[model samples]
Target: MVHQIRPRNSASASMASRKISSMLPSLMRQVIVAFIVGVLAACASRAPAPAPGAPAAQEPAPVRLGPLGGPLAVPGTLSQYRSHWVPVAWEELPGWQDDALHEAWEAWLRNCERPAPAFAPLCPEARRLSIASEEEQRAWMQERLRPYRIESADGNANGLLTSYFEPELQAARVRGDGYEVPLYAPPPGLPARQPWYTREQIETRPEVQAQLAARVIAWVRDPIEALVLHIQGTGRLRVQEADGSTRLVRVAFAGTNNQPYQSVGKWLLERGLVRDATWPGISAWAQANPDRVQEMLWANPRYVFFREEPLDALAADAGPRGAQGVPLTPGRSIAVDRSSIPYGTPVWLASDGPSAHLARLVMAQDTGSAIVGAVRADYFAGSGEAAGELAGRLKQNLRLWALWPRQ
Candidate 1:
């Protein structure tokens, strides 16, 4: 669907003009002030007079979609599935709930500090049990399972922690040992597991230990005010090339704090300018006002302030690899639970001012930090500053369809 252009309110227009003015510095900051003046003078001098009989350009073609897929069954739907949500219960630790821990965790995640080496001792046991030679690990796992007499109807550990715990243990080992974490393909038919690492291993790894120590210190220092929150959102945009080619792009935005912009779709719905809150509806509106696109986004505080890099950077980061380091190519992306959304399903994302009806066939290869709940996804929109901007302004509902499932 396409949106028709309408005159904007004077207030909105004024806000747009102010926003454009403010953006000039950031957008053109690299250029010298004198250069900018000269460029503006040249533009003024070269401004062309409009021809009386000129005709408006034709609108571009609308995005299209293929077949829609059916809904995916939620993971762990089977009786055999076993999963647990382990909350960080550090609050229970006396003097450990202070703000130090929160700060440490953040520093560690940013790779600014290393975890301690105390976690090394636990690595051997973890490796022996889970990541030893394939034969040894398998034998150990079999022996452990023999005691529980736990058997799956499929004879597969479809929902068992044993399937993934070992790998996690190994990962912890590598990280704690100060070795580069090796990315590996999971064995076929195994359920995901939270890789286990010993506390000592966690404390010993420079990065991990730094985080642990920081968190502990923070809690010890300021328990009451140390809480932390994460926020995230995803949206699409219509990008116009200087040569006139147009493309629809999807972006993801993540940040700290409980900001309202974290809910991209909600922010758009509240705007009330678009008739429909869905992706197509908003894309239609954005396309009509190409010149004021950035203004509309900046007007909403929730839609701005992307953590990490900018929009362009983020898109570049989503190279052919999934977040989990899984390889992806055109027509092949990752998907998580179909209940969330099936893997390998094609979706039409409308964003910016153009519609990407068949923009990209995204696979649900990996999960996202905030990608919980049904109908949630983090489209890998590449990486860097451009990607960040695109990600930040992504506030729109989408018409999601599973092209793989005959819907």
Candidate 2:
């Protein structure tokens, strides 16, 4: 749902500049903490596992643990891209031998649908390996590809991992009976690159309303949920149609109003309305200040519209199509900074945190407005309430390695 088509020239540069400028205040606050975390994480890079029967130590080592609870470390040679690429041994990746790579193979197949130039030649072998044994697949990878640690241009490997999911909500074809918030399709004759009416304008002005009247794809019960759907860029709707029949459909991101996106949670925080800006916190504030719900929502001028598509059996089995123009594999897809990691690349990801400890292979299949920087990524956690909950709570430390075919 967070997939976006980003400009590659001046517009993107301007956006990046604005984003960095706006983040200065918060970045300044975390400088010290980030430094400490960076230092600890650097010491643990590309490490190897300890022997199986090794005796327990008095104090747990600072080594990063693999999925199977093995210590990892190995020195690597540094090269450069938009991010630094430090060549490392296959054994350097945590849990390299233990991952259920068959699960990730599906994502790789999807990547073959529109393979990057560098990856197009390898797609044939990748397809052949789909049904190969894990041992055979791992052997082929070691022989054909090289692993490189993905880090910032300055060589720092630690990064942030957040997540996003396709939300599932109930809707009504005709608005009413508590389903007053409308999820829209793009207004007719809307031009790209030009700013449209703001969120407040769309909500409060009759002229704007008239323009969007026929564009209502469906109406949902909660304004907050509608906003969430908008922010995530897509969602699944259990729609009660005018015919009084219920059917599940997906609302995919169609276009936006071209206004700058403002975080309503940030707005609340700035106004001293709430200390926590997460979804739960925002919901709490809305409940306590019901009279100001519209004001809170309008804090974000940007508006996303969606187009409804039927959720057939095939489509229902897969996640939404990413920016790569391929269906994303639930836990095996991640939105990466294309500037750092190109789309269709196979990546090894490791993260240890409260929400989840993950060590697996995932494809760089998507991108987002906030998923900037060399090391940053947004893990696609799939759809429904469980995925949404995981997505909402997952913000943690991350490390990455790109597996590229050797020339």
Best model number under TM-score: 2
- Model 1 Cα displacement at 137 (Å)? 43
Query: Candidates' TM-scores?
Result: 0.26, 0.82
lDDT of 1 by residue, 77-188 (tens): 2122221111112111122112222212211122111211322233344333432454453343223311111112222211100000000011121122222211111122
Which pairs clash (backbone N, Cα, C closer than 3 Å) in model 2? Answer: 46-73, 46-74, 47-72, 47-73, 47-74, 48-72, 48-73
Task: List per-prediction Cα lDDT, in the order shown.
Answer: 0.26, 0.71
Per-residue lDDT of 179 in model 2 = 69
User: Can you give the lDDT of residue 21 in candidate 2?
Assistant: 22
- At residue 302, give the lDDT of candidate 1: 23
Candidate 2 ranges beyond 4 A from true positions: 1-46, 50-81, 278-284
> What lDDT tens digits, residue by residue, belong to model 2 across residues 43-128?
22345675588665233124332332212232121122367666776766888888998999999999999998778888899999
